[model samples]
Target: MSDLNRWMQKHNLCPENILYLYRSDRKTVLHRMDGGEAALYAPMHGVLSVLPEDQFLNISKGIAVNRSQIVNIGNDGVYTMSDGRTFQGRKRGLSSHRRLRMEIGLSDTKPRPMSMSLLEKCSLLDDMPLAFCVIELVFNEDGHGVDFIFRYCNAEMANIEGVPVEEMLDRSFYKVFPNGDKKWLVSYADVALNGTKHTLHDYSPEVDKYLTIHCYQPEPGYCACVLQANEP
Candidate 1:
């Protein structure tokens, strides 16, 4: 069976109860309610396309949040999940908000709730000036690292890549840039698996730019990177 199919069978992700399918670099995770608490299934990619459209909505570039999972929407463009974690909406003027409200069948003038958390505050990174991405390490069955996936990237990183952020979501690093150094993949895997932080000054032939990257693991199996583009 394909990895996507395997994931669906293991998670019992039926159309009836799943709240959303969130994409993070290499995986598409299922978010659902289990016994009044939010449960996230294991991450797998390529499953979103098969889900029923009437039940899911693509809220942001890489995030397809389930309509039932939404508990509140704030005037400040914060979406509060049933589990209390918040995700900021993409900034494309007021129309984005209008579109979201329309998709969820919500009135535009609804009152904004006053609940916000540190995760909501950290959503500001989406608009931050620096280039940032959350990367996940891909491993083989034998536990050897092969490539890195771009789970989440900010607008700055999209600008730096000269591509739409959507194109980078869930894409393997080597597939995106066929000429990228393989050594960087090993470095990323090391940081992700071992939880070591690293800083490197390297030149990217793909974008034809030099970059100073600070990479660290925010959790096991995932690494977050902040980079500055330098002139060659």
Candidate 2:
């Protein structure tokens, strides 16, 4: 294993999540979130003075980038990807070009992994149905309580809960519903972590609203999509 991989494992950073790699002869492992795929490229020994290339794809600068990051290529320069990822490539130096040419069989860098930022992760479930959105709240192994905190809320949930999206990041359901049944929340977390699917229907006096809360534990701390049905 590479030194980088060893270090990342120690920190619980999954190597399978790598997004990109940079190298003069080989690729450097940068972001790794797209199931061990390399999606970006960079020049070795040319970081200081390498000219961008016409064919090189451009995404945003210093963030999630891929060859597809470029939307348009012209005198106006490279444009951001449709999804807002940024990257850029301009004319390459003669030597860099030669090196790139020589390594036609070899990858310029390793697979670049896409790092799923908080916003990007949340965006994963965007536009999902209100019932489907409630599946985000999952229970733990023993069906004791909620394992993962509800980080993102769909439009329907936001309206039903009467809580703004910005207000839900990292905030647990118990905190949101302080006066609600603590035992139920704890039980929900337990079953979620343990890999079970469940749901609860009730009215939230705090929000002065009625909601149908459903949760499915797809994976530990990961598979907790929730759906909220608001009463008219």
Candidate 3:
């Protein structure tokens, strides 16, 4: 057996994964892929050294990714590992992220024209911490006369709302709330959609509610829901 295989076997690494060490002033780690997994090619060349380390070690460990770096995981035990660039896991090596995805399964996928499944959109934004993904209702047109509408939301946003995201997407936002004010929804739309970014402190329409609002045009004709929770 080759030294690489012998080392990998000793380390409990998934098959098709290889470890290469580099000699540099500071120690570095490298992961090489043989199967569907992607190899970190460039950093491998500059790597100072390599060693068998757990993928859950200090955040800086090349194999140990920050929670933010993960995108999604499939039931087949494939993890969508990402660092701006995306990569996939082979088989049983996807345990950690697989569980996280399962916990948020209430946010399922729906067919969409953008070639993006609801799951993908949720997963893309959901990978971030709950604090990062913001949620809010959007309004159509310029006047307070318009009704509140369902707009875009992130994974964390779905969790906070306690409703399956498929139900939330594209629905009239005003319909969900029993006593939502049309004027406030319109003003929110004006600030968010009108290009002036605004922040609110006591913006809550109800008790125990504080929301920070920002606006951007993610696409033509649609206003992005940019909302963050305010602490009590």
Candidate 2 lDDT tens digits, 168-224: 655666667676554454335434334656566776566766666666654433345
Error of 1 at 201 (Å): 0.1
| TM-score, cand. 2 vs. native | 0.37
- Residue 5 accuracy (lDDT) in model 3: 43
Q: Candidate 1 residues 88-168, lDDT tens each?
A: 666556566556666675443322222245235436789889998887755333222255678778889887877688899
TM, every model:
0.46, 0.37, 0.37
Model 1: CA > 4 A from native: 1-122, 140-145
TM-score order, best first, reads 1, 2, 3
Better candidate by lDDT, 1 or 3: 1
lDDT of 1 at 75: 52
Per-candidate Cα lDDT values, in order, are 0.64, 0.42, 0.41
Misplaced by over 4 Å in model 2 are 1-124, 131-148, 230-232
Alpha carbon lDDT at 229, candidate 1: 93
Please identify which of the two predictions, 1 or 2, would achieve the higher lDDT against the true structure. Answer: 1
C-alpha lDDT of candidate 3 relative to the true structure: 0.41
Give the lDDT ranking, best first. 1, 2, 3
Model 3: how far residue 46 lies from native, Å: 76
